[model samples]
Target: MMACAGGQPGTDAERPVLFSVVTEPIVCCPNDPDDAKTLSDVAGAKIDEVFIGSCMTNIGHFRAASKLLEGKKDMPVKLWMAPPTKMDAKQLTEEGHYGVFGAAGARMEMPGCSLCMGNQAQVKEGATVMSTSTRNFPNRLGRGLLVFSAISDGTQS
Candidate 1:
């Protein structure tokens, strides 16, 4: 990577080659409030699976997720948590945050780029996922649209 010093940085050699093109928008959700939405329409929406992992989320995010999972029994959401680093997983496990996820029937994966790349773990087709990754590119998690969520002010998780 070159540092931009007043002028533009990358040369023709630095540019990446294109593969397949995506004509559709990365996120497919409707902007209209009249349509279904997050935390409400998606809540108890009978998602086929769920994945929660990324460098974007820290211990606080996991805690917030646990807060939301609290008191909810018989959850049909197939939850997965794959922290970006081993230390993050360790800390969460130490602080009992992982237990919260475990109690909620969420599986914990070894810290790495698991579902983010559709590599290590993959969600089923026709599933809806809420993630914490910066990009919601098509199939970034799996074969479904991704919603990037963070615990906002006065929000649960």
Candidate 2:
């Protein structure tokens, strides 16, 4: 049993406990040669397009990326942003992030589940993509192999 913030005390049984079975291989970041390749690796090996936004990505991440991409707009890399919601897209637009994107030679898409929904743009075969999307399973994006890494502790990085 745990004390409630303002309501009546609650018991552990009152909570809707959820559990799942592990069915996939869990590995650490790409730097682990025994595991997958890091973002720095396998990048540019054959990838031509890059995606930088998803439900996992937020305004702060966009801002940080914009700052890092300042004054450089000719890297020959295609950068795309798919805002999770219209409101988020609007907020980002109003905050001049679009301008930063433009200056950085980036593009934005309509609010949609470009990655999660699996009904939008897809990575081409034999192409590499650097994405911030959460659904990076085998061939989830397209015919090309989908690979990604995360914090060794199973936390968002």
Candidate 3:
């Protein structure tokens, strides 16, 4: 596996580079009726996955998704929550937010480098994954994988 040293930049030959973009905060879900008409209006496309984890996604993120799915219940997108630490997962579950996520078809994973490491229990080959992780490189997680950086507003694959 390719690994980057602390603050050390890798050359183009050494690194398997991937395209990425910085997007505006996702104030609402992409499927929300009031949001932008298309992804182009909010951000570019070619997204693979939608991640709802990492240190940046706080309780508020879950709350927002939960609220968005309230009453409607059956959310259309597939959401994966990977908290930065075990503590965060416990807090979310203890606070009864897990049910909300579950109701909306979201999966709460253990707090560790699971999917981000390219070792998810069920990722298919040639899958394009959108993530909140900091890096976007080839084979960083899975062989022939395509990874995309996530926006703050919760928009994901």
lDDT tens readout by residue for model 1, 1-157: 2222222346542333231342322222322212222354344444556667776666667777878987666777788888889988888889788878877888888898887677887777657665555555666666655444322222223
lDDT tens digits by residue: candidate 2, 1-157: 2212212236443323122333343322222223443345443455466676667666667676677887877868677777777887788789887788888888777776774444686666655555666656556556654434231222322
Order the candidate numbers by lDDT, best to worst. 1, 2, 3
User: Candidate 2 — which residues are off by over 4 angstroms?
Assistant: 1-46, 149-157
Worst 10 residues of 2 by lDDT: 25-34
List the global CA lDDT of all models: 0.60, 0.58, 0.56
- The C-alpha TM-scores of every prediction are 0.61, 0.62, 0.59
The candidate maximizing TM-score is: 2
Q: Per-residue lDDT for 52 in model 3?
A: 64
lDDT of 2: 0.58
Write one digit per residue (lDDT tens) for candidate 3, span 30-53. Answer: 222122122355465555556666
Residue 76, candidate 2: alpha-carbon lDDT: 81
